[model samples]
Target: MIQRFKASLAITLAIILSFTAVFAGPKDTYASTVAVEAKSAILVDAETGKVLFEKEADLTLPPASMTKMMTEYLVLEAIDEGKISWDTTTQISQYAFDISANPEYSGVGLKLNKDYTVRELYEAMAVNSDNATTIALAELLAGTEGEFVKMMNEKAKEMGLPDYEFVNSSGLNNSHLDGNHPEGTEPDATNLLSARSAALLAYHLINDYPESLEFSGQTTAEIDGQKVTNWNWMIPNMPGSLSQFGYEGVDGLKTGYTDLAGNCFTGTAERSGQRFIAVVMKADSRPSRFRQTAKLFDYGFQQFQRKELFEEGYQIDGESELPVTKGKEDVVELETNDSLSTLVKKGDEENYTIKYNISKDKLDANGKLVAPVEKGQKVGTAELVYSGEDQYDNILSKKTNTVDLVTTSSVEKANWFMLMIGGIGEFFSDIFSGAVDMVKSWF
Candidate 1:
């Protein structure tokens, strides 16, 4: 009989092990995959701002036309704040006409002294990387391009662009560094951005103004009776373009290039309800930036998952029950007040830990929950924290995500008779436990 009992115990242990294996979190290395051939790059989950991958992310480099993203953001913000109207016309200056308004330069064909609406100029600058169009908006918004660059810098400070610097709204720094501008507003001398900072700006812009995608994603637009195609080659197939470097779910962002900056792109792609932002800077070629960004997107979509870590009205621990004193029932169910959510990368879930902390104030002197409990009463909290580090050893978020714990249902006070019965049951349970201890001590 003893041997049979031992055999049964072994089977029970094996079953428990299987159950643990089934429910245990997966073990994974929280790290980026192969590197892209960009001088600096970073890929981040837009919703969570979690960096999935990065290379030289904080190294400052020229942002080229990407600076216009900030310009667009400011203009849009002004329009939203009622400071500027879409129909408001801005006049082109000799500077705007001299810099870009011809076949040699990419622009929406703004002639010197010609008036263009704010909406049309936005299209020209955002879609075609029109330097003149961006400068026109700058002059309108801040009286001069130099002053607009100053506003851009101040906005950058407010937005937490750690290593981002603006020299001009158009990002035409290389050519305009020596051009005439206000003494204090020359962004041309300081137009530099780290991959991480630039990606952050992209995140802010996309989240704040998702409508900007409608303009940036356009493959072609007409300006001054002439059709102009966006310089970005990742906008899928157009009528005349034979490029197949397009990616699905890639909506809008911005691309940049210059002799000193090489090729760069701040790309945002959404797949399966998950959006990822990738910034590739100083790539060897224009197509290389798009290809590198696509690589990051592919990895992001495949390697990470958006998971509801904790659910409302569910016990954080698989089995959690609290004994209630002088209540209609002997026990009550506990649940989380809110669901804690996160984008967990594959192979790194096991490292994510959830800790439950029950409130001591909720219990009586005997360590049992008292009667007359109300549902949804805040009893405690559960902290969900991720322990993954980026390549730079930077903890993605130093703060822990938490959810509140609460009672699932009310516990009315039990009648005197029922309370006496519960007390007797508890007394018997303690007696039985003591007896078992005595038996074990005999062994």
Candidate 2:
């Protein structure tokens, strides 16, 4: 009878565990399908910079006018720094006039010598995809297109945008113009860029210039009282158009096309307060570009979602307090260089844990820190760990999230020479006093 009861209890426990396992939500799966024409693509969370999906994303390919994205980025940077303002007016130069005349190659049709506000010009450049307006804005910002190109390249380097090169403010293909130039003609090569770099540029621009959406996302605008329409037809006509996709939060981005480069696009979409950037390059046709982009965006929104791992200004375990050798303060604090946050799935928090490992050392007596301390100092590391029976089932599963936690402030090192001299003087004084006391006692 006892054996039978024990067997029955075991059977019940096994059944309950099996039921719990079966009822748990489905594990994450990377469900993606790329059309044959797509040569390279990438999708990323604009907030966390997490790459959700990618195919040949780092492969270098001609970006066509998508090069204009960088031009747009620099222009916004100029505005933010107060170098120019929306109402500021600029004259149309001869170069700008030339570019506007070539309709096949130019996106703008501005009349030469006409003055337009910085605001109007930005709309013409971004909304209409105006090449002439892009050149004009670059010249106005840097005195010449060449100087502006230099600034663009410099900014690219600073941003770690490797594999990107800008020979002109507008990424017009320059191979046709090369060696055919008259004396003093600036070399024109269509701006060449990769899918990854283009996405990076889009990511940085939207992040840096949130206000730029008012222009790029605009389907129609009146500049100098003239109506202009945006070139990005996907915003208005695509099946999962920004409005239809419920990506009303979507804004500011650009598109590109050239016979050699095929159709290329870089766009951002936002929903429920989370923004994502998607890039598709070298599609077979204009329509296909939209289709491919839609698919990529769908895959991102459907397959993954962003979750906050930690709140900003939330303190994780810091380095153990270290004794200050001779300073007024007894201890120093350590923290992360920035706040800790990550993109996570809907119900994975229960399996995640944050772990901290800090160094054990005390500051010296002379208020000197040991050698090897660096600015934005990193003295320890923190990691996030996920554990469950089937944690590895998901493609985006993360076993741990690690970040460097560094010293929050600078540590002043003591002058060893001064300390040595002071110590020596004290020792000699003590010896002299002891000898004098001994002589006095003998007397």
Which has the greatest TM-score?
A: 1
Candidate 1: C-alpha lDDT: 0.77
lDDT of 1 by residue, 101-146 (tens): 4554465667776778998999988888888888889999999887
C-alpha RMSD by candidate, in order:
14.2, 16.0
Quick one: best lDDT, which candidate? 1
lDDT tens digits, residue span 1-443, model 2: 01223323433644564466455442222222434347777777786566666655555667887888888889889888998988899987776777777768644567876788888888888887877788788889988877787788788777666457676766666554334222223444445566677777887887788887778888777765677666666564433343343234446578888776778888887777777788888888877776777777766676566665654333555433444433334455655554455555556567766665664542355544464344457666666565743232111223235677666555565467855766788899999999999999998
* Candidate 2, position 3, lDDT: 21
In order of appearance, the predictions have TM-scores of: 0.76, 0.67
In model 1, what are the clashing residue pairs, if there are any?
28-347, 167-187, 167-188
Output the lDDT of residue 205, model 2. 83
Worst 10 residues of 1 by lDDT: 1-10
Name the 10 consecutive residues with the lowest summed lDDT in model 2.
Answer: 390-399
